[model samples]
Target: MSAPPYHPVVPANPADADAIVACWWTLMAVHGPIDGRMYETVPDAQRVYREHVRRQIDASKGVVLVAPTPDEQGIKGYLLGGLGQRSKVYAVREVGMIFDVAVHPDHRRQGVGEALVQAALRRFRLRGLSDVQVTWSPENRLAHGFWQKMGFAPLLIEAYRKL
Candidate 1:
C-alpha cells in the first residue's frame, strides 16, 4: 500500500473540535482489542475525550495538535500537551506535559505518533521550554517501549487503586 500523505501539526481550534473528537473516538475503538480495559465503548470514550481532553485546552494551559489527512480534512492523529510544573519527576520550573497522544489504528506504525511527538516538542522549544514528559500506564509495555525509543526515560511511578 502507498504511504498516507503527511501534514504538519497545527493548533487545534474550536472549528477542529469535531474532527478531533472523531479521531479520538476512532482511536479508542481501534485499540479496544488491546486496551479494552480503559474504555468499554465508543460513547464512553467520547465522553471522556470531551470532558477531559477537549475541556483542558485553554489560554492558560496548553494546545492540541492535529494531523489531518491531506486528501481528507478528518484528523488521523493528535497530540495534547501543556506547560506545567510537574514536581513528581523534578523541580523543574517549566516543562511540557504530554497529556495524551493517539493515532488512528489504520495509521499506526507509520511514524504518525513519532511525528506528532516531534511536533509537540518543536512547539515546546518554540515556546522556550526545555523539558518534556509523558506519563503512561506501567502495564502498557508497548507504550513504554515506544516512549523509550523516543528517548524518554522513566522518572517516577504512580500507582492507583479503587476505593
Candidate 2:
C-alpha cells in the first residue's frame, strides 16, 4: 500500500484556537455517545473552551500542536498538552498531561493524530518531563486502542457513580 499522507505538525498560534476547539468538540461528540454523563457539556462550552485554548497558546508550560490540512487552509487535527504538577509529596512532582487530542473524521487512520502526539511528546521531553499522561473513556474503542498502541498502560482507574 502507498504511504499515508504526511501532514506536518506545527505549534498552534492564537488564530488556530477556533480550529483546535472545533476538533475538540468533534472528539467530545465521539465520547458523548460512549457515555453521555461522563462527557456532558455546558451551554457555553464552545466559548469557554476557545478561551482555554487561547490561554494554553500563551501559557509557558502548555503545548498546543496542530496538523495542517494538505491544502493548508485549515487544521486536520490537534493535540493539547502541558506541564502539570502533582502534590509536593510525590517524587514525580512534574508531569506532562495531554488534555485532549482529535483528528477530523476524514483524516483518521492517516497518521495525523499520531503525528500531533509525537510532536507534543518531543516538546514534553524538551521541557524535562519524564512522564506523560492521557485520559480517555474506557468504553471508547477507538480511544482505548489508539492510546494502547501509543504505549500507554493504565496507571489509574477512575470510577464514577451517578446519584
Candidate 3:
C-alpha cells in the first residue's frame, strides 16, 4: 500500500498554537485512561495549553515543529523540544528535552511522528547537544514502544504516591 502523503516538518509559529493544543488534547485523551491522576485534564486545559504552546514557540531555547495536513489548512502532528541543563553535579550540561509529541489518530503510523522526532533531533544536534531526554507514562504502551523505537532508553524512573 502507498503511504499517505505528508508535509515536511517545519518550525511552528504563533499561528500554529491552536492546532498544537488540539494535538496535545488528543495525547491526553490517550494517556488519561492510562493514569487518570497523572493525566487529569483541567477544565481550562485548552486555554492553558494554548498559552503554553505560544510561549514555547517564542522561547529562545525551545523548538516547536509541526506537520501540516496535506491540504495545509491544519496540522496532523507536532513536537515540542527545548534545551535544558542538568544539575551542576551532572557532567552533561546542555541537554535536549523532547517536552511533548503527538500525532492525530488519522496520521498515526504514517511517519508523521517519526518525522517530527527526526527533525527535533537534527535541531538538537545542530545546537551541539549530545544528550536528549523524554518522559512518558509507563502504562502508555504506544509511547513506551514509540520512544524505545526512536532509540531512547529509560534513564530515570519517577515514583509517586498520594500523601
Candidate 4:
C-alpha cells in the first residue's frame, strides 16, 4: 500500500534514535525468518542497535537519513549507509555499504525507500565512491525486489549450514 506523504530524506538527529530503533526492530522482525532466528527481544535489540547507530553517526561512516511522516509526526523510514572497503569475505575493494534501511509497513509501497537509497547514493557520490553494495536476507523477496529495482546486481552468494 502507498504510504502517506513523507518528507524527502534528511539527516536524522540524535533525538530520532528511538524511532529509528523501533523501525529497525520492525525491519528485523519482518526479515528474521529469512536471515536467522533473532534471539534478542525487541528491547534488547533496540539497546544494541541504538548504540551501534550512534557510533556510526558519530564516526561519519556515511549518512543517516530519515523520511519523516507528514507534519513531522514521526519517521516513516530511515537509511544507514557508509563508506568502507568491501568485506574480505568478498573479492572487491572499497565500496559504499548500505548498512541498514527500513520503512514502516504502512509506507512500504510509497517512494520513501527509494528516496532514502538515492539520498545515500548522493552522499556516496559526494565522497567519490561509485561502486556500492547491499546485503539482504536471502529469503526476503521484498528486499530482493527493491534492491534489484535500485540497479544492484548480485555479486556474491552466501551459503551456510547450521552446525
> Which has the greatest lDDT?
3
Local distance difference test values of all predictions, in order: 0.76, 0.90, 0.91, 0.83
Could you give me the TM-score of model 3 versus the true structure? 0.94
Mind sharing the TM-score for model 2? 0.94
Evaluated at residue 126, the lDDT of candidate 3 is: 94
Residue pairs in candidate 3 whose N, alpha carbon or C atoms collide under 3 angstroms: none
Candidate 4: where is the Cα deviation over 4 Å?
A: 1-6, 38-43, 87-92
The better candidate by lDDT, 2 or 4, is 2
Candidate 2, residues 1-163, lDDT tens digits: the string is 9976677999999989888888989988888888888689999999999999999999999899999987877899999989898998999999999989999888899888888888988888988889998998888888899999888998999998889
Q: What is the lDDT of residue 73 in candidate 4?
A: 71
Residue 41, candidate 3: how far off, in angstroms? Answer: 2.0
What tens digits encode model 1's per-residue C-alpha lDDT throughout 81-117?
Answer: 8888755766668889897788877678878888888
At residue 74, candidate 2 shows an lDDT of 89
lDDT of 1 at 17: 70
> Where is model 1 more than 4 Å wrong at Cα?
1-7, 26-48, 51-57, 87-91
lDDT of 3 by residue, 44-152 (tens): 9899989988998999998899999878789989999899988899889899999899999888988899999999999999999998999988888888999999999
Residue 154, candidate 2: Cα error in Å is 0.6
TM per model? Answer: 0.77, 0.94, 0.94, 0.86
